[model samples]
Target: MNAKKKDPIKSLGIYCHVPFCVKKCAYCDFCSFSGQNSQTIADYFKALQQEIRSFALARFNSDVGDLAFPVVDTIYFGGGTPSSVSPEYIQKTMAVINEVFTVSEAAEKTIEINPGTLSASKAESYKAAGFNRVSVGLQVWQDELLKMLGRVHQQSDFIQCMEILRSVGFNNISVDVMYGLPGQKLEDLTATLAELMAFSPTHLSCYSLILEAGTPMTNLVKAGRLVLPSEDLEREMHWTIDRFLKAHGYSHYEISSYCRPGYESRHNLKYWEMVPYLGFGLGASGFYNGVRSVNTSDLKEYGRLIAAGKSPAKYEPPMSEGELMSEWMFLGLRKLNGIDDADFKKQFNRSFFAIYQEAIDSLLKAELLVQDGSVLRLTPKGQDFENQVSLAFF
Candidate 1:
């Protein structure tokens, strides 16, 4: 019999950040800009293309010496709002990426969209440009809440956007929702979920509101103009989402992510599983070759540096074995199915139980973690207190 053919190369994920939005949300702290003229937007994409071309495989091969070139298996266009710009920019950027990288034919390509920013023309353009997935930012169903969050789009915009996307033959859709917002009630969350479920989105990301320092929303809470939900109420909201989506045939595969079976975000899984990936654009973070890289947040600096043939990123020293193991445990535990001891041993050449026995014993005794043969997973209660459980492993 002929020997089984070996796979040619390992896979890598690509994240292209488009840091432009129509307007800034009150709660957002991501590295994004608004109110830019056409010139600025055009300049940014030019710089972005330069940044993409800068990572040509020849250059990467010289840096890594003998490291095998990775085939790009996933590409994610995330942003302040990727859809706010002209579809031609997206198309051209995709063209540049294809020129520089060895992207797989069946790669999962995704783009983030703001509801109001998308149109029928843009939706069809995205389909022609080869985007297989769309993640829409629809934090809540109530117009009042959207206004409070400084979101430009309302429920109607979301509905229209979904229709346009479907009309363009795009079916792999993910809707982002938020819970535990200031003045948000349990009933409000359920109502939002109910309205969104009508769209039958293949993936759903339910996030809790986190007050970032210096953001407008945080200032309101600090000044007593708004109040976040109490801890008990927030916990109830989390569980409510869990029960509601699971009943609707969505799998709660990761913390804050639910998907119809087999529809999990492949790009996101790369982060949790510690697979290699490259991040292009301002303030993007990437990990590969055991090193973590973060691009400069300053747009002008990023453009200038790339123009000068220098990287605008800060590279961290490669992670030690202990650090990698800790990250593996924490990130892996974010999944509902948790981590595998056998997989850990295979990666590190050490037994997971032997290393984390004390921490594991304490958590298991407290009923926060359960060991099912070689697999360890968070209990329902443990999921609620994920931070505390993670601290034990650290």
Candidate 2:
């Protein structure tokens, strides 16, 4: 008898990285820069379009005899700041994507914006270009904190941007805020949440500040010119915001993300669920068909590769089965609900407990994990040390 045939993967997510910003924040180490001429920006867009088309054509050619083309269920335009570019650039990219791929009728499209760069016309253009979700970066509420973080936008700018987005008929808006900043107080966070609640954004991503190595913020801390909040204070700030958001009708769906019912980020959830995605543009990464790939970070290199009709991917290594399982556990556990045992077994053809019984037993004994029937999740205490729990799988 012939062996059973496996099903082909479908329903991909597309991520486009727009590596431009009006100004680089002190804490940011992303591959984005400020102050480029219009010609440079225009050239980058041309290369980006060529790369998108080339990738699509290659994917289509590979799937020649397949029953159905892979459908794109989500598209995320992440930044530096996607809104930094002119709206026409966004429209042209969307046009290219639609020309090459089959975008699902109910696809979720999202774009990131910085309050300092968002304008009313741009907001309207985004809506017209089929961006149904908008995430605005409003790192903090206080002007002093904003300046300390080297953000160009003041508190007033964020409020005004929110107003513009609303007036332009954007219903699904997510606001990004941060905690654990230098000299941040509990009252400051509370006040920020209060003001944000007034806007009634559908989603909130409240992240704790991490002092990455070699960033300006880290240098200042090392030089004793800046002092971050104490660990206790940071923890307090995290839980305080979580509880407050829950009380205000936002579900803490993920460790750092809270959303109203049905407003969770579809594209980001794909990452946690191990769904395949295609990534375009400088420094973007993608995981598809058992392979993980990253585009080159250098603009000149990326442009050169695309111009030569070559793949701009700097790396494309297929993941081993063990690596895939480890990633599944690590990403799945990041969700507030944790990993589903049944789903794990279905995906890997192995029982979760059978593979990680010792690790599970140890965590259970340590009161870090709790098993409730088919689901395994982090305890409230475990959530505080999630890194430790995730490391167990490794």
Candidate 3:
């Protein structure tokens, strides 16, 4: 095998999946089960730590080649609810991480929390555990909507959570919210926005509701029990959020992500920047060098493989350079700022203008793309047609 083929990207982000929850949300299609998930939380953490240690050793043998080192730049704990883990569990994970990887002195360590699960003590403990950032999913402010979403927390709980987060010295807080639900109105989104902005979180990730197959939400849609707003209405609502947030000094760096200046998500940027990060645990996917791989989604299988001292990965393949380049365009265009021409040229040693001339011409002709210097970004019209513009790359 070629040595060049095995070299991963420079930076490392370790994503630890904590797939346990108190109650499953109605619209949730994630790899989470309420009681069943909690049963294995402790064991999963143990497996995850061992997996990271193995990956670190492999990287030392493969990528580093000559050095004894752990080169993780970020550590992200995401899940059904990472904060739902007992404080001791979180501490144990951090301890394992410290023992294995040489985390950056200023690494962006983060953990996801739900309002009901996160408390002042836990928040402070997380801070002490080296988690500098926390993202809380406060999906909707309306109690009715919260109930409908089957969220275990209330609007007051969200406020209380934020207060606790502040008291616990979590400065880099992120708020996650959603829109475009079957029963959601534009006014409802406005109310949600008002509540979120009042908290002045450093970062916000806004996701449109996606009805995944096998979920109750999908069943409702198929059964005609749910009627989603038309695409035009959804786009309109998205644009409204975009405009409002931009006006309020939130950097619309990504399609669904906004941040205060200097607060853009570093771990997420690793993805769009086409940097490789290790994904450990069930259902986690990662891109390293030109290769992409995903771990088995089954928790039992994951544990079995880890216990056997093996990667839980189901499939791993090296992507062709063309495929990698296409993915670069795909991911980069999702950022509102657009991709840089020079970076593309440097990476592929070819001009993007020459490569996708017809697509570019057609997009600009349709007034969907605004070409400013060597940069190309979607116009408001293009944002409305983002899917079509993205398809141009493929």
TM match of model 1 to true structure: 0.96
Q: What is the lDDT of residue 46 in candidate 1?
A: 92
Query: Local distance difference test, per candidate?
Result: 0.90, 0.89, 0.83
Question: Mind giving the per-residue lDDT tens digits that candidate 2 earns over 277-350?
Answer: 98999999998887889999999999899999999886566888889998898788888888888999889999
Model 1, span 1-394: residue lDDT tens? 1111223387899999999999999999999999988998898899898888767543443555335556889999999899999999999999888776778999999999999899999998888889999999999999999999999999999999999999989999999999999999999999999998899999999999999999999999999999999999999999999999999999999989999999999999999999989899999999988899999999889989988988878999999998899889988999999999999988998888899999999989988999999988999989988998889877
Name the better of 1 and 3 by TM-score. 1
lDDT of 1: 0.90
What local lDDT score does residue 286 receive in model 2, on the 0 to 100 scale?
Answer: 90
The lowest-lDDT stretch of 10 consecutive residues in candidate 2 is 1-10
Comparison by TM-score, 2 against 3, better one: 2
* TM-scores for all predictions: 0.96, 0.96, 0.93
The top-ranked prediction according to lDDT is: 1
Candidates sorted by lDDT, best first: 1, 2, 3
